[model samples]
Target chain A: MKSRNLPLNKRGFNFEMIMWIFTRLSALAMYTLLLIGFIGALLMGAREQMNFADVMRWAFMPNPSHVINTNIPDIAPWTALFWQLVASALLLVATAHGVHGLVVIADDYIVTSNGRKIVRLISMLMMASTSLIGLYILWTF
Target chain B: MGITRNVGLMTALRYKGQGPMLTFVLHRLGGMGMAVFIAIHMLSSFLGGKGGQFVNAIYEHWSFQLVIFFFVLFHAINGLRITIIDLLPKLLEYQREAIWVEWLVFIPVYGFAVFVIVSTALGSGG
Candidate 1:
């Protein structure tokens, strides 16, 4: 007699696939983002607009409340902060997705009691690192 | 039925595979490519240790432009492709199309870089 094939539900891998899908998305976005950067680097208008003295002259320009304004660049520090916020928010979502995938992949192979514990410990460490960095970017942005 | 193979003990197991696993494989490969480049960049920065004269020279090197541009172009284009894959899995078949688009975008951008470099070189005697 021939055997039957199992359905997806019946043989489900049951992997809670948490893909830090953002890393891939952001990675890809970041990949080609510099095409326009060639234009940015060539832009000497900023260089032309403000001589070092003039740049220093504008040192007392109005800054937003959040900026600690320690040793940041002269011209719009808040503009830099805006982009940083956007980036770190995406990172938060991405890290969560990554954590999910890591947990699932770990669950798949770790069989022994000690092995499972170690895997969990390592995953948690990596995840905590991702979170801390993400938060730092956000808070300091 | 058109989409159906009869489901019984006699039926063979089927994978409802929507994409060529090759796409999945290549995605990781491309990610790794970007990562290795980034690692080298960070290492160089670390080795250079703050802004010394050597570090400044490396930053300004035209040779590094190739590294910077190629990595940036691929990273963004391949990333956009992966984004589409995640958001719209059905369009995964056209993964190659995305790479082609990347190349398409790369051409003019690279051309302009050449233009800039050439102009800067010839114009440098002043």
Candidate 2:
């Protein structure tokens, strides 16, 4: 009897391997964002460095406090556009990949594609909403 | 769950060895460890005004050697695991033994963290 061997493919030979890569990459990206953000916070000093209020000084203003209705605190704009923006963007990318990786785990467990689809939808929605919230928070700072 | 089992078809395949499952599991546990710390980081970021008290609390309790020891171990082990899976593909063969060794090290690490947290918490007049 003869046996067949599989051929190699790039973009990873299988989904699990791909998910593995995604987790590692996402972790690394998160680590980078964290380190940068921490460094930024420490450099700014006591009251002025952190807090939604300090960052809000630069990130948001409604022209008047009473207008739009919601009591959103003004967040400060980041001191530097370069690393901070890069870090925030990287976080978004990591969040996207993280959701995708988790979806793969879900797909591995859920037998039905319909269930998988629903899960993916919910996952994406939550991720998108969080991403937006994070962005809004960053922007307000 | 069934989809995950028997699907050992690891890509970038090199060598295979029967290794202790504990080490591999511990490596994953590192992820949970980092996650706990990350949660603290986020929450602490929001704790903005209490910089001094916050720093003091951390130092007076979870910031000591035992805690740091476990934290560093988990981070190092997980980081090692990530490096192995992502970068050094050849190491998967001996991964079992490597993982077990990690667990052996983890024994002391865990002991230290537990001791630190307990002692510190107790010392805090809790």
Candidate 3:
């Protein structure tokens, strides 16, 4: 009796399965994070009476006008530190999900075993280095 | 099925087929593009933080920033759409509809970003 072969993506609670699950969950998290960042930015801009154009201009070229003029208290140092930590966490999750997603994509298109291996290796290296660099930058801030 | 799976430059341009299938391809492409941008972003942030000339040179290019923004926006929006369809299994029955809804949401949000980015860039004499 011959047995059927399972697809590489579905290996029954194996590495691929875990990575697949991580990608989905991370994507959901990323959606929330990205939304928060965008909304927060827009709100900040609005409070400063800056339109989207002004906000974007400020992004490209920071000026005194971009500074918060509201009577609201300034954010504490710890709050800034907390946000940096959040950003770092986002970086790690996004990189892992994106790298694995790309590898799986490469797997779908790349027929040869060697080609897939090469792609996965390169992706892993890139993911690791980028995450490290991003974390380093975040901590410095 | 008739679409040949050949390896070539053109292979990258060809879609596997229409609608949902195309969406899947685009999502993956967007993911890859975002991943690349994130990597570059890490390096750029590091350099820019140190006031490196390389970072300023790259940041000066509006086109690069535009592409990055577009890719990330698409990925985030489409990703949410995908999450919705996955979490609500019943929505699978309306996969086609879901995809259409995804695009409907995507276009306006993306268009707004483009308008802001382009208008600002051009207005700033970039």
Q: Which candidate is the best by DockQ?
A: 3
- Ordering by lDDT: 3, 2, 1
Lowest summed lDDT over 10 consecutive residues: which window, candidate 2 chain B?
B11-20
lDDT of 1 by residue, A41-100 (tens): 225233544322222212211112222322334435444554454445544544454454
Candidate that scores best on lDDT: 3
- How many pairs of residues in model 1 come into backbone collision? 11
* Sort order, TM-score high to low: 3, 2, 1
Cα lDDT tens digits for candidate 1, B1-126: 023335664442354433434444444454445434433433443345555436545634555544554444444455566677767777666766766775687677666665554554456551
Task: Give the TM-scores of the predictions, in the order they appear.
Answer: 0.45, 0.49, 0.74
Model 3 lDDT tens row, A64-127: 2222432224533223554565566677887788778878777776868688779988997988
Provide the global lDDT of candidate 3 against the true structure.
Answer: 0.65
Worst 10 residues of 1 chain B by lDDT: B11-20
Candidate 2 docking class: incorrect
Q: Report the candidate with higher TM-score, 1 versus 2.
A: 2
lDDT of 3 at A79: 33
Q: What is the overall TM-score of model 2 with all chains considered together? A: 0.49
Taken over the whole model, the C-alpha lDDT of each candidate is 0.47, 0.51, 0.65
lDDT of 2 by residue, A1-141 (tens): 233355657445686676677667766665565455545544544244333322221221111111112232342333346644764675476557546645655575686768877997888786776566555544554
- Model 3 ranges off by over 4 Å: A1-11, A39-46, A49-79, B1-16, B47-52
- What TM-score does the first chain of candidate 1 have? 0.41
True contacts kept of each: 0.18, 0.03, 0.63
